[model samples]
Target: MASVSRVASRILVPFLVVLGALLWLVLGAVAWAMQPPTTEQLATYLDDASLAARAAEARSYGNHLMRPELLERARFKAENLSRQNQGLAPLDPEVYTPPAAWRGMPTTGTVKVLAVCIAFADKAPVTPVETIRSKLYGAGTGSGFPYESLSAYYERASYGKLHIEGEVLGWYTTSNARSAVTETTAGREELIEEALDHYDALGHDFSQYDNNGDGRIDYILVYWTGEHGAWASFWWGYQTSFWATSYSVDGKRLGDYSWQWELYSWPSGSYTPLVAIHETGHALGLPDYYDYDGNTGPDGGVGGLDMMDANKGDHNAFSKFVLDWLTPAVLSRGRRAVSLAPSGEQPEALILFPQADGQPFGEYFLVQNRWRVQNDTPLPTDGLTVWHVDAQTDGWDYLFDNSYAGHKLLRLMEADGLEEIEAGGGADAGDYYRAGSRFGPDTAPASSGYDGAASGVRIDDISLDTVATTIGFRAEAGPGGLPTAALGLLLDE
Candidate 1:
């Protein structure tokens, strides 16, 4: 009787195992069937032929921001990392070297500005002390040009964390002709000497301008007395500096070096505060966003979307984030919903479609809300703004004949073709969103998507209210989504 019972138990146990396996298979099949068809359709659209082609194009030019040698070294390191993970030995860095760009990085955030007002032959005479206080320092006057306005701009742009500590140090009369203001080293030195002498005579210690007593001035704002014409104002500071001032570091006087500074003519009645704002961006490691051609057009890739691109425009989220103005709430792959308050108030932006290819720097799509407020004087329109970001070490915009010396870090996402950009137009129709605009990777033609990509970030659904001006948009990861962790490294700040 015991032998018979053991035989039945073994047979029943095997039968129960088979039934459980069958039930699991049936449930899995039903769950797969219940998924929305749109999910499958979206997955298909993400991989559509057009999107694949555009992504290839975007990829080819994605490294335009890195110097050739730098990119190659990055590639080698990545390969070595992969090999190590596979239990292989790492490569020697002494044999494979990175470029100078990698060795030395640019400075960003909380730039200290020392401003001087120079009177040249009384034509653009020394700006009135009151006027300088108002316009340059944002001090003491209702109608005065508020330096605070510019400070507020930076503070708001940086989400109230970063801003400039600036003041009009002193006023001086320089007898030199305005044309003598060459951007050359000797010329700038001469002007600086004269301004320093003037301060010395007044018994004002220029050292007070050094807020941190760092022995080196982070930035200098030389406001020459007069406007020569349209071309008189510009930013000219060597990417690297050897010159130093007589300021003491520890016990010795290691002169202050002029690494980054801007020389601009005093703002005539016609000038807007943005001129100072735009040039200061240069001191903080930003490049000109407009086309650099001697002739004019909407030739810049960023066009009017950024302050670096045009005068008095809202800054793009990429620029703001890089400068440590704001940090984005990391977006995950697949589908998700996003609600953006005005960038000035909430300073929130969404990132999507990170680069997946082995390229060192992957492309990123940024979405933020832009509206008119304090310092963003004249935006094209109040709506959502998108940006497609890629960086080039020796990048030249299609508009330039020669490569620019420093980093070219961004590109604007347009809603239409070149027609959407106008030379002096702030932000325009095709470059931004409005109340009824449908946003998606493929919804708008390539003419209207980021970098003219027909398919990339699928904007899926969007709803905007004019009165409230709150923007609610949905975006999903398209094909070739890079590891979210990799993007986080690129934007560690």
Candidate 2:
């Protein structure tokens, strides 16, 4: 009896200790869940070492917002030349059009890019060549190391209509030091010339990069070894027309090129491709949607909602139309019901014109169905997004100077009647038009032009489903300003 009692005690003691520890762990987990850390408190625990490194990198670049004004001018000239070549009249200097041919990269079919990995004599590249390649052209989710490759992002954004194929070459050492190369614009230009010269000497053909056979390389991405300069500096990631107009290799001229840092280590050490995607939008001839002068207040533009804005999500519907990736169904002067599929999944949208013969290049409204899927996962909500665009207003002047009476060239028509987006707030769940929403002249922000002219366009009875959103449009004007009753009969047909 005594021996059996000793054995039972040994096993019971160990079991009880284990059970107590399990219970304690569960209680602790529950307590943590009940009082999670606030965002500010949670931020305190983040590794500041990485933040300091990024800051140091920015300091190295001398903190300049290298606005590409010269590049914009050059692209503007090239676009006018393209129009002339196509036997179309050149637009007025104030007018802007979607770029094509020499104006920007082609938006269709397979477009090849030439990526050069450059390193200064003193600063060696931290990211490997293969890693950079994966980030540019990897196949699957993990293939790009931290996120999807640049190619995958574009392929999905374009609905597979546009494909990016390219080769990444070299850890080519430059003859100059990092300080020398980053000293001036001319220094950076020399580095590019040197890098291309080395590749040309190696018998690599450059003619294939010009997808449109336009005697210029469609686009070139240069990965320099260092931390990225924040906005505009010697080391900042930017797209511009190469300054050396007289230089060429393999009988091809280098025109538009994007310069990027070799690695991105912020918040955590990882190679994210958001910056590259945003700069590439510029290379493709899309203007920045954010306020360039930092005057985003009381009438804010798209705040971190677009790739060309804060570099957050997929390109907006207006950008897609500019790229010729999607065709929007036009809504003229009549009452009609339309069903719009998810713009991210389908190449469809609605464009409402104020006039019967209103030109697309003028003032209009673009409506798209946005869903929180794919690259649009960062979107604040999923529903119908309405955009009021004034393309006649120079995007550069208004975006840079903030002199347009707080009016953005491209402004979001917030559905919640709050004008939060215009009141220095970002997109929220209420900004999207859900079921039962009505937008017309009676709404808080009437469907009117910047000049306060009634567009006479009304969107009503918005409804949503899993796959699409349906909306009704009622235009007050008919052909020759006929009565709505007369157009009602014609519209019914």
User: Largest TM-score belongs to which candidate?
Assistant: 2
Q: lDDT, candidate 2, residue 95?
A: 57
**Candidate 1 structure lDDT:** 0.46
- Best prediction by lDDT: 2
lDDT (Cα, tens digit) per residue for candidate 1, span 53-136 = 322332232221322343444345444533432345777877666444332112234445666666655444534655554554
Question: After superposing candidate 2, which stretches have Cα over 4 Å from the reference?
Answer: 1-101, 140-147, 229-231, 266-268, 295-299, 358-360, 393-406, 467-493
RMSD of 1: 23.1
TM-score to native of every candidate shown: 0.62, 0.73
What's model 1's lDDT at 242? 20
TM-score of 1: 0.62
Clashes of 1: 19
lDDT of each: 0.46, 0.60
How well is each residue in 397-462 modelled by candidate 2, as lDDT tens digits?
A: 323211123566577788888875554456567878777776777887788877788787777766
Which runs of model 1 end up more than 4 angstroms from their true locations?
A: 1-111, 121-126, 139-148, 175-184, 208-214, 227-272, 294-298, 356-360, 392-409, 417-419, 422-427, 439-455, 466-468, 479-493
